[model samples]
Target: MDPHRLLIFREVARTESIAAAARRLGWTQPAVSQHLRRLERQAGLPLVVRHSRGIRLTEAGATLLRHADAIATRLHAAEDDMAALADLAAGTVRLAAFPSACATLVPTAMTNLARHRPGLEIRMTQCEPPAATTLVTSGEADLAVLFSHDSRLPDHGPDLQLIPLTDDPVRLVVPTGHPAATAAAPLTCLASTPWIAGCPSCATHLAHTCEAAGFSPDVQHSTDDYVVVQNLVARGLGVALLPQLALDAYHHPDVRALPLATTERALYLLCHREALQIPAVAETVRALQQAATAHRPQTPPAT
Candidate 1:
């Protein structure tokens, strides 16, 4: 099968709609259909099946798409490598960072990379830590900045390589006017206060932290936005457990962040073991380490 046809088929598989693929590729729908037909004839199997809403990949289609993704990643890496040889500073680093990390760490990392290698292109996407790991594993991102609570690090997928970047501590945030703000006791003192949390995965980390403190948090509001969580806490809606990075990124006067007596979250730079050989990806890993080190949280003042 022609590589171009395979690429088209892959796009269709990803978008799950021939028309969406055509729009993404800037090709007409008929051209996309024609390309898929050519690929199907060459493969001697129907790669995709249509349904009322859209389309789904057949079993063979799923397997072929996975292979196609790997092939495309390798081809792109080859092009990037050749370009880097002629101009060491010029190449793109596709990064996926969780939303909180993206807010501060990525911008700082990009700034550092620009100063050192101005020609390097840095692209970033905001995704949760687990999804970011998946992006790197699937070759969709050259590198991903992922975070896990202390308990979760050893459980990272075996296929991925993890490089320690920072050990960020989780902090308790309370409205400035709340009684908990002036309390010097452990985090368990606020156990009865309502909590604002993120998704299930993030909430699980918070739950573990609370469980260790001898109580479970009452989650009154749950959302994926750290900023919104901060806002809700600022308004006296509920207390929240947040990472120091997120707290640093958001400095609302209405909320005060207190250090947790115990608990630290580790942030890692992740990549497929195979992708580390690429100079751009290697440089990105270095940049992330530098940024994380430079931006680490200082010990909070005695409260």
Candidate 2:
């Protein structure tokens, strides 16, 4: 099948209108229609039906849409792999990471990559944890750095692969002057205190932790900005539940982070299963694992 025709058909099916697909693809409407017709002829089936306002996929079209998406994803990965090989001394590795992970883990990972694989280019974007998996699965990023609480894991699509990087404990952050800051007690003791939260996924993790402690936390503020969240806590607005990573990277004089009695979160490296086979990706993964191993905390000898 013609790749161009399959691409056009995929776009038309996604938009449910030839005009919209043409606009998206930067092609004239007639051109899009012709591509769709050729695709249908190659498949020997009626792929689409005209609707009063747009178009609807026939049964055969729906089946082919799934295959088209997979094919497009693989083709893009192949191109990226080829480009990386062509310029082994200099090629980009696109990455998506959560805000806290970006600040704490990614800096070290990138530094390691630079020292060891200086030829490998690194590009990173801060994304909400929920969206990180999608970015990798859809081929928008070559790799994703993501985190999951002990109670909940982020869902990457089945075709995506995960590699464990670090298992860090979650901590509670409060204003230094707050009574809870000095107390050596379980997180449940602060349930009634107003809490600042990260994005929805982080909030869910906090909620789960609180539930295990036998009460739902009173969330007073929520934001995707890690710096803003720390600033809010510093101003005594409320406390927050966060990973040790945030404490390590964004510590403030007014904010104190306490280890939670129970709960640890896992940070992971995610990529499409198909992309993992690429040589550049494999080398990058090795660099990341080495970075993680070197940075992992060592247990002190018991007295």
Candidate 3:
């Protein structure tokens, strides 16, 4: 397949509309359709089905789109490398991080970068770990700040390296003046108490922590927002297990926090091995490591 046509096909597949892709690429609708036709003819099969509203990819098209996306990723990485050669200070670092990390770690990292590498541009995206991983893998982001529960180890292929930043301890939050508030390391004390869970992974981590204390928690509410979780806990509706970073971002006055008995979530900076060769990306990584260390309580500095 023509490399250019493959990129066009990838864009069309992403937009799910030939006209939309045409608008984006500044080409006429018919011109984009003609290229799709040529690409399909070269493949010996129809890659997409025409529709009144938009196009739908056939199985063959879906298969080919994956290859096209891979090609696009490679092209983007090549562009980043060439840009790196032109000027380290002028290069851009695209960073994707989860919400809490954005709230706690990113600001400090960006501030340090601005002071030291004034000309380097840092673009930030808010995403959970999985989506952040996708951004780094596809070359949409130069690096990602992500976390994993103690029960889960991240393996994002050999091409990418996950640099350990800090161990974010999970804390149990209870309503102020609640019975569990005065209990020392009250994780077991709350096993029978109603609970508010955070994201799915956090909920799972909470469950495992409670299980280690010999009883399962009775979860009654769920929310992705740590603020919401804290408010729910403050209302005496349910207690919650939250990462230390979330509390660092915003702690509700009516909630009492205590460390979980045994669970510690790890924060990591994920990136392609080759990406570190670029000075801007490397500096951003260093700054992130420093930020994570500063934010973490009693954490040792990264090597």
Candidate 4:
């Protein structure tokens, strides 16, 4: 199949109208329609059904659309590869990261990169780990800063590589006068206390840890924002488990952070294996490591 024709068909399939696809591609509608016709002839099947509303893909079109999307992703990666050969000062590096990492590590890395390579273009997207990983793997971003509560991360597939960035110790965050607002929280101290949780993955890890400590947390509220989590805790809504970076990013005066022995979020940089060949991406990675190292927290001893 012709790759160019596949791309045109993919665009039309996405927009559901040849004219809309043409507008986006800067081509005439008849030209796009002709390409689709030729593509269908090559496939030997009716690829689309047209009606007053728009277009609908036939079964064969749906199947081929998946391949077309993959081809498009590969083409984008090829573009990045060619761009990597250019001067480092003129290259671009894209990064995706979760909110906490964005708040702490990313800014530092970005600043350092800008200082060292003034002409380099750095782009960033704020997303959770799952979305961040997908962005890097799909060639949408060159590198991703993501976290896993699990020390052992799952296999993210063969196309990707991971580098451990730093360890962010988890802490017990409680209202000022809460019973466990001390240096070391045995966790059992808050067994019957109402709990506030963060993202789903963090909540799952919190639940498992609580169970291991001989009780299940009575989670009463949830929020993904670290600032919100600390603010809620300060208002005495419920206590929470938070990573050190959350406190480092923004801490509420009315809440206290106590040590949670053995619990920590493992931070990592994820990227396509080929991404590191680009000078801009490599420099970004090095800067990220330095930032992570500088901000690394000292895990409080278990009391």
Candidate 5:
């Protein structure tokens, strides 16, 4: 089968729609359909079935897709190898990171790397942990910055390496002048309070933390944006638990942050183990580590 046809078929299989694949590839629908037809003919079987919803891959298509994924991975590795040959002086370092990290750490690191290696190019995309991991493992991104509360989050693959960046504490956010703002407020103290939670994972973590404190939070709002969560708290709609990095990035003056004694999220940097040999990747890792260290909040001296 033609490599080009195989890639086109793979895209179609991924999106489950010829039009969507064409849109992604910047081609017309007819072009994508034609390519799929050619690929199916070469394989000597029907690859997809059309329905009102979209398309579903046939058994043959599924079988071919498996090989296509492997080929794509190999091709991506080849591209990375060739780029590595260019050394640190030139080539792109693609990065995928969650919003909080992007807002806090990425800019400083990018600026530092740019000054150190003017010829190096950096590209970044904001993504959640799972998507960022996928981008790194699929070779779409050279590195990924992610966070998790669980200490034992699984690695993407055997060849992938994860570096712990920092443990960012979770802080309780309350409207300015609220009773909890000036005093030490434990998780149990906020049990009956209406709360604005972060994303699903963050909400789960918050719930677990509250449960461990012997109470369940009355979650009144749910959103992925930290700023929005803070605003909600500021408006006296609810309270929230926000990551330290996010608070550092954008602190709402209308709200106050109180440190939580029992909750924190672990930040991490992910990349292929072999990619470290490349000068650009090594330099980027260094820059990221420096940024992470600089951004980490210092603990107050014990009284």
Candidate 6:
């Protein structure tokens, strides 16, 4: 089968409209239609049916789409592998990382990559784990630096390879004069305290941790930015549970960061199994590992 024709068919199957597929592929509608006709001839089956609303795939088209998807994946893998073999000296390494990782680990890693692999271009996008995972899986990103609460990573296929880099402990931020400011206790100590959650995911984690400790947190505020969360706590707005990475990146002086020994998010450098073979991917992984080592919280900061 012609890979180009298969690609056009896949796009049409995805959009369910030849014109929409042509627009997405930057090809004229006639060109896309021609390719689909040729593909149907090769397969000796009616692949699509036109109706007033749009096109619907025949059973043959659906079956062929599955094969086309696999073929595209393999072809992309081949390109990655060939790039790996061709040059360690120059290539773009697309990276997706969460905001906190972007503020800390990613910058350090990029610095090291700059010093060590000067010819490599590092393109970064700040994304939460869910979006980052999709980008890596779809080959939009070469790799992603992501974090999960214990083993609570999002569901994905075996194609994703997770490499453990570090564990960022969750910490409690209290106003400077709050009781917990100078004391270390299980998160239950703040059970009755009003809370500020970093993100919806962090809020869920906080609620779960508190529930596990016998109560639910009263999350009075929410924001995805840790710096904002810390600022709110510093001003005595409310206490919060935050990851050590965010604290490392930016902590307000008026807030005391107390260790929550029982809670932590594990950081992983994630890549597609095929991407691991790319030399730039391997190089960036090493750089990220070095940064993680330096930033990994070895001990709880003094209260």
What's the TM-score of each model vs. the native?
0.69, 0.66, 0.69, 0.70, 0.69, 0.70
**lDDT at 264 for candidate 4?**
91
Instruction: Write the residue-wise lDDT of candidate 2 on 229-249 in tens digits.
Output: 778989988888767666666
Residue-by-residue lDDT tens digits, candidate 1, 97-191: 98878888899989988998888888999988778877777789888888877557734568788888888887888887677667666476778
Candidate 3 lands at a TM-score of 0.69
The residue-by-residue lDDT of candidate 6 on 108-221, one tens digit each, is 999988887888778999999889889988889999988888568655569899888888898878888787655545466788888887665777888888888799888888
> Candidate 5: where is the Cα deviation over 4 Å?
1-87, 182-185, 300-303
Off by over 4 Å in 3: 1-87, 299-303
Instruction: Give per-candidate clash totals.
Output: 0, 0, 0, 0, 0, 0
Q: Looking at model 3, how many pairs of residues clash? A: 0
The better candidate by lDDT, 4 or 6, is: 4
lDDT of 5: 0.86
- Higher lDDT: candidate 1 or 2? 1
Task: Record all residue pairs in model 4 with backbone atoms less than 3 Å apart, i.e. clashing.
Answer: none
Which portions of model 6 miss their true places by more than 4 Å? 1-87, 183-186
The true-versus-predicted C-alpha distance at residue 151 of model 6, in Å, is: 2.9
Each model's C-alpha lDDT? 0.83, 0.79, 0.86, 0.86, 0.86, 0.85
The runs of at least 3 residues in candidate 4 whose Cα sits more than 4 Å from the true structure, single-residue gaps closed, are 1-87, 183-185, 299-303
**Candidate 5 lDDT by residue in tens digits, 1-303:** 999889999999999998899999999999999988888889999999989877999999999999999999999988886775466766788999999999989999999878977778889999899899999899899999988884657358888999888788888888888777555545666778898887777988888888887988998788999999988988989998888888888988898888767578898899999888888888888999999999988881111
Global CA lDDT computed for model 4: 0.86
Task: Give the per-residue Cα lDDT of candidate 3 at 124.
Answer: 97
Candidate 1 vs candidate 3, TM-score winner: 1
- Evaluate residue 142 in candidate 4 and report its C-alpha lDDT on the 0 to 100 scale: 89
lDDT of 2 at 237: 87
